[model samples]
Target: MFTWNFQYISKARLSSTLKQLNLSAEQGDILIRIHTAIHLADEAVDLARFVKELVPKAVIFGTSCMAVINKGNYALNRCIISVSTFSEATVCSEVIPIMDEYTGTVLPVDMLCGQIKKEFVRDNTKLILTFFSGQYKDAGHFVDRCNDFFPSVPMTGGIASCAQNNQDDFSDDGFVFNEKGWSDRAILVAALSGDKLENLSSFATGARVIGDESEITDTFRNCILSINGKNAS
Candidate 1:
């Protein structure tokens, strides 16, 4: 496995780094995480073309982030690309569009869960990495359904968020890209299986709890109807 960090969005620099890796595209898959500030958002199609030319058979998956976590530190406006070559392990990915009707109502939780299970449930699956559009109103419920489906398998991912600067202004909506192209309202899931790869998952939240614990008593879709003895609202 090899990971490279680029502070600036430069196709020349990216190509140079890939050349240095001395890897063949047929060997493994590539995962890329980019900050939304980078102009790569404007030239994503061209970038995908360039990567495909380099590794025609390699599966490419990428997503935009508010900030990239690198080397135990958060980096702003940076791009992190990880290339992995697994001789004995297997890797595969699938993209599912968010189910939204013309009226903008999303599919029910049970239906969404069924969609995920139909696409990703497989034998020997060890790790699942997911990336979803931050615009989805029910992203939390979607994640909970995923967790319930794959309780034994480790899963990690986040909602794509726009870039922010010191002024706190956000720009450039986030997206996810794959061999089929990119979309702003889709979920990308990658599964890795085999004995050659070891996986560990962890998460951290910036919010701190200040009040007493409350039990969620009622819910409707993604909204909580009541908590403890009072209405959630």
Candidate 2:
């Protein structure tokens, strides 16, 4: 496994930095995850595209994130590329459409689980990394269902977050991008499988909340209309 955190300027500089990896000569099954806080869909796509062009055989996927957190530290307006090569494991990735285009309906979790299982044996599949758009409301449920289906396998990922728009609305601020393309209503999933594969480990930062908890009295959809009987700021 290898990771790079850098402030991306242009394709020329990106190419120079990527050369450090020697991806050209690197062989074996590989997966490249590109997470960026650039706040632009084009930037995310461009980054993924360049990496995929360099190693077309690798399973490349990622999304625009609010920030990059590594080893307990975090940064914004930067990009992170994580490359993992496996000689004993199998990895597959795809954009799972969670909502119907024409019908405008939220698809069931069954379809999502089907796609993950269809790529590898359910018993052998050991790890799953899923990236969902910030606008995707079903992300939480998706996790729950995956845990129900793949009881032994570990699942991890986060929402693709973006800054609020000028009007303070977050309707379409985030997206998921892969080698093929980017989408807002879909999710990117990578499934790994191998006889020796293990996904029992995980970690978190030392950050914690210290302020007093306030009671919420009312709510409007996902927003809080009032707290402690007072209007929410």
Candidate 3:
């Protein structure tokens, strides 16, 4: 079995974030999620590169979001770094641009899943932490395909949002990146694998309705495909 440790740090404390992380052991990852009214795409690239320089070997990836929350405080333009160090587990990263840079075409769902299939390991893959482009509304389709191919390993992640300020202006500036490159229309994926790697993601909202369990028979990306043989509204 492998163990992992995480620490969430704000931009104000970023200088020490890496030092505090146990990277000396040399097997870990650094994930950043930035949500800023003034966060520029170029700045994100710089931040990713800067961290990569320091760690040199850790898998680094992240996404630009509309808002970022940490420990109880919320900030629109703050940089929050989520660092994960693992022992007895391994991680790999992939950044796939859904939009064809040459032809300016959007990749279809099946094709996108095909790209993942090339590297996906059914049994060894323990978890999928991805930051998907918010522009693509077909995330549910991707999830469905993943479930079909690798049902046992849980997939978890968030959709990127480029919206900024009170006007909620969503632009094409949203991006996801890995150590190799960054893309405004890509999916940043970090796959973790281990025989006993467990998923510990959870949340609680006192007594609030969590909704009833329902079987989803179909889906079209982010839209509901079907439920109990009935068309989803």
Best by lDDT: 2
Q: Residue 96's C-alpha lDDT in candidate 2?
A: 79
| C-alpha TM-scores of all predictions | 0.74, 0.76, 0.75
Better of 1 and 3 by lDDT: 1
TM-score of candidate 2 to 2 decimals: 0.76
**Candidate 1 residue-wise lDDT, 1-233, digit = tens:** 55555553577877787788776646565554433444344455457667667767666777767677768888776666666666556777776777575765666766766776677766667788888866566777777877787677778877777666521443245777764667777787887777667777877789998799889999986689999968999
Query: What are the runs in model 3 whose C-alpha is more than 4 Å off?
Result: 1-13, 25-38, 166-173, 202-233
Residue range 132-217, candidate 3, lDDT tens digits: 87777778878888777667777888787774763243347577765565677888777788776677765665776467978888
RMSD of 3: 4.7
Clashing residue pairs in all predictions, respectively, total 0, 0, 4
The regions of model 1 sitting more than 4 angstroms off are 1-9, 25-36, 40-42, 71-73, 101-104, 165-173, 205-233
Cα RMSD to the true fold for all candidates: 5.0, 7.1, 4.7
**Ranking of predictions according to lDDT:** 2, 1, 3
